[model samples]
Target: MDGDVENAPLTDEQVSDQWKRLADLINKLQARTDTKDEFNARPGSSLTGDDAWSPPFHVSHAVNACIVAGADHLHACKTLVVDAHSLHVAAPASLIRGSLENMAAAFWMLHPTSRAERVTRCLRWQMVNAKNARRALAPLDLKDPASYDERIATILEVAQRHPEIDIAAVKRGFTSTAAVTYADEHSGAALGVLLPWQLCSGFAHGFTWANLAFSERVEIPTADPDVFSVRFSTDLTRALYLVWAATNLTESVLKLHAQRSTPQY
Candidate 1:
């Protein structure tokens, strides 16, 4: 069935039927309301110590982002299933890539060392925001310079409170390359996740190769656009793989949160 979908040029009816199957599978997976609830719940702090588990602000934020990404991926998949246009499908491919990347980051942050790295990254992120705020404060004749000054002051005040965050050190330590490398070393799924990510990125960036999806060769030349109708065919195997990957990442994140929530006896 999967081979037929991938190899044969499907009719409009076949395309609709395949889309229905894909939508049904997504719906079935999404029906696990309890899991989704647990995912959204406030995560506990520590896993094994006498101290009560209280998730830090960053940990909570990461979990929230992961959950949101999962939902976004599902939504994108559903949208593409219905639309099935070459241009429209690129949006979901891009979304899935982003979701996978976020999952990878969350996985790395679950570890102690990686968590520290993430903290440094957060500090650097704040620094970048401050820098941008400063740039916005640049005097412009049309814009009110005083208003920019007030915003810049507010940002600077916040920055002063975190005097311990060495911007240079944080910049040096918080690299995405290092994070992905760490994930690869530990989880062993980095490459598998990244391969699809790269492929999707090609489509997102509007590369020539990606545009080949819209190309069709016909033995008989036809002037009518409808003569060679190009309806996007659903790749069941790819859809199933995406669903499985999203579910796996979701489970891993939830398990991590649960592990941290429970204290060791």
Candidate 2:
């Protein structure tokens, strides 16, 4: 599945078809709605009582939030390409990476049929969110130091109440590095989610190895023998296909979110 978009070259017709599909998917994603975008009073998101259940937290807020972000990333990608008039070497893949990660998070939360696991994924994502915020604020002098801790405690408290969720599993929270692969399995995309994500990740980080793997390099003749100058150029077809993978995964998220969302009253 991941091999659907590989280092191997595609024919002209294949390129044209995939590129058109990419555009169509992006257009569809932009047009999609985020209905029932509401949330409960937090510390917990629940059905009836003071108990902060995980299910409502995801269905009501987190999934919508994630899909919205994925849409924004694709919007940004379009803006960048239009503004620059070309893929601009690395930026498209970087933007696509972010979109895929956002979609992957949403998919991971919503793909599960069991409500307990679904909510658990959302809880872990939020737990990580709080932890990150706390770490970012650690160097600064904050008025309330325990705010993030309270958030973490809140997630754990909810997890504790759900007997099906293993307490230890939610400790570290969610990270796309491991979960992206799992989410990709359900994406229903020809070009699977994980490889494109990985390729885009390398571009996002500006890794030399990623460039070496994906780009065409030609040695430049330099007067100074000591300076081994080289020119690197990106393959537009390859870049587009990677981004297409992101759109496919994101489109899946949008549809899944609609199914999971409460109907608008």
Q: Write the per-residue lDDT of candidate 1 for residues 22-44, one digit (tens) a residue.
A: 56655554554325544443323
Enumerate residue pairs that collide in model 1. 45-53, 45-54, 46-53
TM-scores, each model vs. reference: 0.54, 0.80
Report lDDT (CA) for all predictions.
0.49, 0.71
- The regions of model 2 sitting more than 4 angstroms off are 1-21, 33-52, 82-84, 223-227, 262-265
lDDT of 2 at 4: 53
lDDT of 2 by residue, 165-252 (tens): 7578788787888678887787687778898888889988988877888877888878998886877787657677777777778767
- Candidate closest to the true structure, highest TM-score: 2
Which pairs of residues collide in candidate 2? none
Clashes of 2: 0
The true-structure Cα RMSD of candidate 1 reads: 7.9
RMSD of each: 7.9, 4.9
